[model samples]
Target: MSAEPTAETLSRPPTTSGEAVAVHGVTRRFGDVVALDDVSLDVGPGEIVGLLGPNGAGKSTLLSLVSGQRRPDTGTVRLFGGDPRDARSRTRLGVTPQETGLPPTLRVGEVADFVGGHFPDPVPTPELLEQFGLTDLARKQTGALSGGQKRRLAIALSLVGRPRVVLLDEPTTGLDVSARQALWDAIRQYHAGGGTVLLTSHYLEEVQALARRVVVIDRGAVRADDSLDAVLRRVALRRVVLTAPADLSTWAGVVRSRPVDGAPPERQELFTPDADVLVRDLVVSDVEFRDLEIRGASLEEAFAEMVAPESTPESTPESSPSIEGAVR
Candidate 1:
């Protein structure tokens, strides 16, 4: 067997291609379990694409193929117009897996230096550390850092090579809101410099904040791939929240309803395709309500709808079909 590719081997000169990533008719499986099935996608240079899916939905599997950690059972995966498995093709690619292992005895700065040493042109260690709020922790040992700090450090290390494309898998999993926002800014700054990113996140707001394009996968297949706005617009459900004396789950046009947890017993949330018609009908029926709120469906709601088993053509917006309450 051949030796595993080292960081230096994967840090060759960058490619000047227009497309940063391309995967076509790909399928991957682990024994009898299919992780990705007949998937195809292309990402252009400088684009920030969000890959969203529930746990075990093949998000990681797809990333593995593009990053050359695993091969597709069929079809091709490319980075900068070359085969992804080739070390030269991965030269411009940086990646942070969901879990990263660091040398326990190495200081933070040392770790960054070690990774940066593999590339011909690396971001200065100090500058890279400062960009991710890790300057103060430079002397800390990897084993001693907090979970959030370690997460930040891992992401910072990915950029040390000045890679043209970065793959982040749940990049902000352990971060607080402020740290998460800081990382977002760092990612934006990198993208401003023409870096491309393909990230997977469980945080809907994270995707909303950073990604112009969204790709959603479920059951090892691509369910939706489109611009952020287009994907949200595909969800016809509108959200309506109000406080009422009686249950409104049976209301005409309500596709789903559930009580707002932790709120007053009378507070309820409902989803309908046409909020205007629902509100007018509530007024016509003289139903007493207060604190009424109506808004477009959120990304969470849109995701829930798209992944629902009944979201097919047979269940149009006009159909009074019900689904489990939208993901909170």
Candidate 2:
């Protein structure tokens, strides 16, 4: 490991206003196909920002550009106030790309040792392996590890540096629920130790669980950026599942309702945020509720709605989406 500035030197906290990572008016094109278009966003130090989008939405392109693996055709990108290609930037950042870059024939420990050499004050190789639950697999070739093991090993390589900023591109791809939970725990610990994390994931649940804020991109542009709660509230979808005692005839503003096709034929309800008022109206209509369950808008629904084709018009007016809801 390379020598590092001591805690006293690094103790000056980053400014809340100045971005830890910034992308301004960024644009990238490959033979006229725009991968990114005039996009701008920032990540604050010690924040976990979820970068989200559908397939071909340019999430990977944005990450690659920031990591210096690929450069933008137009606009500026800065990491801790410097170009990503700068030596300081490279040393301060850790990246786990979607594709595993490890050599198949290399032993797990060897790979960690190699990557660890690039950082200042690298974690001990043995400790790194243990931290990622790869200690038993240390002597095994990378090729022999199972998919989940390989992914975990890849994460270990990135963490060897104890980087200030971490770019995790789909960090939980192959893991089962338990393994994913373990990874989330580790990431939380990283943040607690003062690391900033930027993640791109197809799993909405994962983002909701892990990210404090989220940025949704679609069609090469930013669609939404705000706190996770804000995105869900903006979508404003409501689900009301209930069993009714009466026939429950038509009620105004009730979007859709159907009898669940079970032996009991309980009712399943779907509606918007207007359901609160509609429920009041239901009393006048003499509807009886035997059982009722209400669920607020979910991140999955918000993400789908934001990236849906029809929401394209909403993307232009705001650089990023804003939310006004409290974190639950």
Which candidate has the top score in TM-score?
1
lDDT of 1 by residue, 153-222 (tens): 8888778888989999988876789888778877877776677889987666677788889898876788
The per-residue C-alpha lDDT of model 1 at residue 158 equals: 78
Instruction: Please give the lDDT score for candidate 1.
Output: 0.79
Q: Give the TM-score of candidate 1.
A: 0.77
Clashes of 2: 2
Quote each prediction's TM-score: 0.77, 0.74
- The candidate scoring highest on lDDT is 1
What's the true lDDT of residue 166 in model 2? 89
Q: Name the weakest run of 10 consecutive residues (lDDT summed) in model 2.
A: 319-328
Instruction: Write the residue-wise lDDT of candidate 2 on 218-281 in tens digits.
Output: 7789988999888655555666667776544245665434444442654655445566876777
